[model samples]
Target: MNDTPITLSRADSSPPRSRSATWLSLGIGALVTLVALYLIVRSVNFELTLLAIRSANLWLVLAALGVQLAAMLFVIRRWQILLRPYPTRYNELTQIYFSAHLLNTILPAKMGTLARILLAAEMENLNVGFVFGSIAIEKVLDSLVMLLLLAVIAPFVPMPEWLRETVTASVLLVLLLLLLLVSVARFRSALLNAVTRFETRLFGAQSTRLALLVRGVIESLMNLTRRRELASVLFWTVCAILAGGLVNQLLFAALDISVPWSATWFVMVVLQIGTRVPALPANLGVFHYVVILALSVYSVNENTALAYAILLHLVVFVLPALIGALCALPISARLFALLTNRTQPTTE
Candidate 1:
């Protein structure tokens, strides 16, 4: 008798356990922040760290920011390629991409990612599942590039246990996801049928809608395997990763942290992969922890190392977030409406 669409709203999609999990994640993030801050305060001479920051070349810092901002363009292009079926404008995607970065920095639980997916879906008249799927593909590509860098750097550098475990876990996760995609492609019909039957037994009357949503998600996963799309996506992804490494190297130079070029990969790898764990907004304590740990491997002192990490976080997270917020203001009304509106559902 009821015919309302199933929206991905907190009340509809998220069960009690999911809400509990979110609270638990927040608690973990808070604890991590406290521990990081405690360690930093105990180990580093705050005055000396401040002096190191003050002594940093202002022009070089600005140049580092510039390089990081430039790298975001390649990232946006890669995102656009993944979103081929929906076909968004270059300028619009740029705005959305950076806006998501702003959200990711300020919000917890990767909500920035969710923000972009929803924003793109709303703006482009596309299914949310499709957009989400594209984002997942982007993440997979990022993991592959990160793993490649680790492979290249592992032989020469004495990797820390944390770094080794992170890489191993990442590699296994990527492999599993790739295998899952292939399996779905090979047995699409059978998988869809199984999903439909499960939904039918679970939701009864709402099974039709749920089945359609599931099918869309599965199809989007399969789309990543298409040769042309995969090739283009991977190429841009690699470019983005290299550009990121360049940004880190420039930042290292700006802060006067002299290390080998490959050391940048170490910094990039840990920051990129380590922050994947639950942490405070903008990766807070987690970012500094990983950066200091990575730099320590190259014999950098705690005071100067913390300075580099703090400045790098500012360039990577804070400045871009500020710029992104400014650029996204014009479109904020629609984005806010989409996020807040509860009764209406965009169809699959």
Candidate 2:
């Protein structure tokens, strides 16, 4: 019997997939750099030097980072809360730090999703299929909640035609996803049996594995099936969303610019969705490109917009990354774990 911990097959041939993702991501990055440069050069205030760091809204930016951090803390707490019924010991903040942004920088696709799943699986020595199914459920819930917040804040802003269309389509997509999950939950047994039947007809041992995977997904969904549990998670989620909105608002506030609260929500939603489209490391170029595009359409001045976009990203990106590294290495030799987690791209 293998008593010591055994690492799973790390020879994930997923590197081939990552190689393709990298080239595509790099292209976006290059385009982003071009766009940012264009905006900076053409801006009406190109002659204006940046405000000294001392004179700028240092307190407000720090406060914004604090709010963002707290919002993430709440999300971690919410995840821990949701898993209360399960046997799991996730550190509220540490997991979120590593799972959301840190792994986001390092992983490909939705490796942050996989990171949390892998961490949970390792810590509890649980089934990968079941743990990962929880991740899928979590992702769906996250998308739906963000869209719901976006919808609620929509009425407060004068949205441009482009954003309005995007939001409308996204809302429908979110609805479709929610309905699909509900249908699966309703007909889980039939779905499972059908999948098992199909698998058995095809690959024998592989079908057995597929059936197990199906069961795990279904079981994870079952964990959230209770109205009480769902409601509890939603309550905390609502708080986090509000906190996130504040962070977005403060991002603009730090620029000495005022956008409608609705605009803040819009930017946050846009940035979250935009960056996921396979950008370069740290979203290097694309971050400025998307934010500038979004703000320009909103009639924000180009110079102020570029300044706001880059500065806000620095706060949100670099600060969290540094903190994530520190937190991961605070006590344990997880410094290597952080390096392992940070250097390697995520496997969604």
Candidate 3:
């Protein structure tokens, strides 16, 4: 049997807000990007950066590109496995995944995930909560794997004071995430009840549909904790993490920079944590800065590190985004139609 479908429009998902607030968000995002770009331009020598890019090993660079694509495939497979017990077309999901990824690389504050979730729910007629629940589970698994890898490799890497602080910060972040998951899992009913009362009071008659969506989301979260499916989710997530590390190592080789394969975990950790900081579109300056900092810990030259960061980010961000845009065009049209036709006012 197919999974039950849940329909949602923007009106159902987002609380009504003012246009001025939307403009404020865009203005802030634009300001952040401009500042980040200014900092990057000041720091790197354009001539030297261009020279470094030209010097990269083309064969290894191509191989690195291949590795990045494979890594994405692994992640999508993991998502596929997570969405199991709910049948979905593999090809359709792949398109949505890539399209969502493209938007994510371009947009700030991770709107890509929600865009994909809403698009997928609209197209597949799947429950929004189920799709979102799978993504949430993916995040939890990613955090745990990061912590485990760090612990296993910490002894080998020298414990400089700065490194120690970074490790500590990462640990705290993981723990905080874990605590949040536990709280939600344990107290879902209370949380849902509180939110439901607020929505009903605020939205009046419109609250009935919104309350149902809230219930669907909470139920999906609860259902995902079931042991059989959870195991598959965990296993595939590990593959995705390992695949990420491989992408880092391949990019290192592509740049002809020597670092221990294990050290790539440090690169992976730093890169992930760094990008989490709010930045302009495509993670421009933030990605390069964190990569250079991570490699500098191992005594890599700043120019070479900058080159590596630039090439890797280009391959990682650009290629998929271009391809995903092509895939998303038709899908996005359908989503647009759904948004226009299905949205209704809260009072109605």
Top TM-score prediction, candidate number:
1
Q: How accurate is candidate 3 locally (lDDT)?
A: 0.72
lDDT of 2 by residue, 28-55 (tens): 6667656655655665464442542334
Root-mean-square deviation per candidate: 4.0, 5.4, 3.4
Ranking by TM-score: 1, 3, 2
- Per-residue C-alpha lDDT of model 1 across residues 122-233, encoded as one tens digit per residue: 6665556666777887777778778888889888788888777777888899999888777877887887798788878998956465555555566567667689977887
- The C-alpha TM-scores of every prediction are 0.90, 0.79, 0.85
In terms of TM-score, which candidate is stronger, 1 or 3? Answer: 1
lDDT of 2: 0.63
Better of 2 and 3 by TM-score: 3
The lowest-lDDT stretch of 10 consecutive residues in candidate 3 is 339-348
Q: lDDT tens string, model 3, 1-348?
A: 125555565566655445576466556766765776676677777788788789888887777777778778777877777666666777888898888888778765565786777776766666666677668767767767877887788777764576567668878877886676566678877877887788889878555665666655665555456787667666766776776777777778777789876678988877766666566667877788778778877888777888988887887898889988998887776655443445453332
Model 1 is weakest, by summed lDDT over 10 consecutive residues, at: 1-10
Q: Which stretches of candidate 3 lie above 4 Å from their native place?
A: 1-3, 16-43, 159-170, 183-198, 335-348
lDDT-superior candidate, 2 or 3? 3
**Candidate 3 TM-score to native:** 0.85
